[model samples]
Target: MTTKKYADFIYKQTKGVCNIMVEQMFSDYVLYKDGKRIGALYDNKLLLVSTENLNKLFPNAVQEKSFDWGYYKLIHIENTEDKELLEKAVRITYDDLYFQKDFVTDISYLFKVNKRYQDSITKIYNLHITFLRFCYDKGLLKINPLDKQDRILHMNFLNNDLTENGTKIFNELYDKWLVYTDKNDDKTDDRIVNTKMLEKYYLSIIDKLQINS
Candidate 1:
């Protein structure tokens, strides 16, 4: 059984990261960052989502099944007293869960296609939906996936938080959208076909990421 004192100690060790939250589950505790679950204190042990970056950071950390029936496993962190490492581990796990590295690589490929030839609106819309779905599934974003207005609001929030590369990518995508719209003359049939193709591409990326995760 895990004590509140031990759970509090674990939470304290990982306190500096932004939006870190914890919830008690009977005797154990689950940890979250930016609304995504990153780790937990179970049976007095610290268990974090296993990822390539995390594995490299703590090569000797023991990996174990999260549950008897689940395929996903977690890394058992032994040294909870090292506050800096604990914080780093939580951040790494959260990031890996939030944005799988391979997803970035796959999206970059789409960005490389000629702007004049790409279906920019379809691509952008699908990308937005894909991002929202991923975040929603991971408990990072809260909104009905089917609600257009809510999606628009949250997507705006995401756009506001874009990194340098992210901003550049969005700009390129917007330019492509303008080109596609001008060329297509707002044809519904053409838009539908483009949306279908982009949907398949985005879904494949999600499938690959989930399989690896």
Candidate 2:
């Protein structure tokens, strides 16, 4: 675990050289530069992110494995009073990992499209409800939110517009919501609950993907 003091020290040290953001992950703090992860602060030590490029650059850097699938070299920045050295190390790592454009922009754009599609589908579904209400008011057609048109519109939106991963996530949440619906008999109300759950999931995935970029 990274203490707040240690994490702040590393973050403050790199201030003039580049922008760094610290993220808390299961009690440990990981640092990112330009939307790309640069290092992690674990056990009060700052270690540059391990990669083939980093390995080549610092061959003698010790290999410290933090988990089953990953390890990184000690950047020798821990508790050091040498600001110049700290600044230089941060600059090199940031420059090496930084890209011309951050991938977050693309993810944001993708979600914007997804949001537009979701909004359009919702409007259409509401329009159908309004039409059905108008018809019923005029004694033309009796309808509810679960009418045939509603089902068809929902299925088309799910199958055609949603990506495979998105579909999988939605299906999983939908299955759970199905259980809730079975017990409570209120599917429409649970839709809001499921939507909130999906929003959190999507945000987490986007953050992970952006950091990995």
Candidate 3:
């Protein structure tokens, strides 16, 4: 069984790499970075998610099944005193899992909005808004794009932190919403069509940004 003291120790050791968080799961502790599970402390042992790069880096490290029925395995780091190696392993594992598996692709797949109305433009807009709000709620976005007060803050974050492609994607999405608001006159039943178009556009932007990142 894992104790809180040991879990806190492990978290303190690896937190310098990123925003590592520890959550109790029964008697063990699972670790997360930016809302993505990266590792865990099982049986008072530090176990990180097994990744190709991490396995290559630590060829002789012990491997164990993550759970009784799960196909995924975890790497056991025996040298708990070596904080440097632990941090490096956590960082590499996090990068591999987050960028390769759980980034924008998962977001798009998990939060896809269903088109229920054929002609209700407001409904389409609201559904898209819900998707963005979901992203914020899930800790994917630092600023809520739907909030008018967060407009400047969000733009500043894009300009300062994200890559050129990321910034462009966000700007294009924001511009699309702005255009929709500016031209509120609906002459035809194009809400469904526009909703599909916007969803595709949003996904493409995420994909491009992920590739560039």
Q: Please, what are the lDDT tens digits per residue for candidate 2 over residues 1-213?
A: 779987787778776665668888887887787566777777887777554555555566765565322443445334346777666666567655553122211213333454757754454344334333332332222222145544422212212233334333434433443343333234544443344544454445546545321
User: What's the distance in Å from true for residue 35, model 2?
Assistant: 2.3
**TM per candidate:** 0.49, 0.39, 0.49
lDDT of 1 by residue, 128-157 (tens): 564445444433333444365534343333
- Overall lDDT per candidate, in order of appearance: 0.61, 0.50, 0.64
RMSD of 2: 16.4
* Model 2: CA > 4 A from native: 51-59, 68-79, 100-213
Better of 1 and 2 by TM-score: 1
Model 2 lDDT, full chain set: 0.50
Stretches off by above 4 angstroms in model 1 are 65-69, 100-213
Ordered from best to worst TM-score, the candidate numbers read: 3, 1, 2
lDDT (Cα, tens digit) per residue for candidate 3, span 1-213: 899999989988887876789999988888898888887888888888889999988899988665541566888888878889888888889877765343232222212343443344454445456445543543445456667532222212323333334434655664564455333356333442355556566777678666432
Error of 3 at 213 (Å): 16
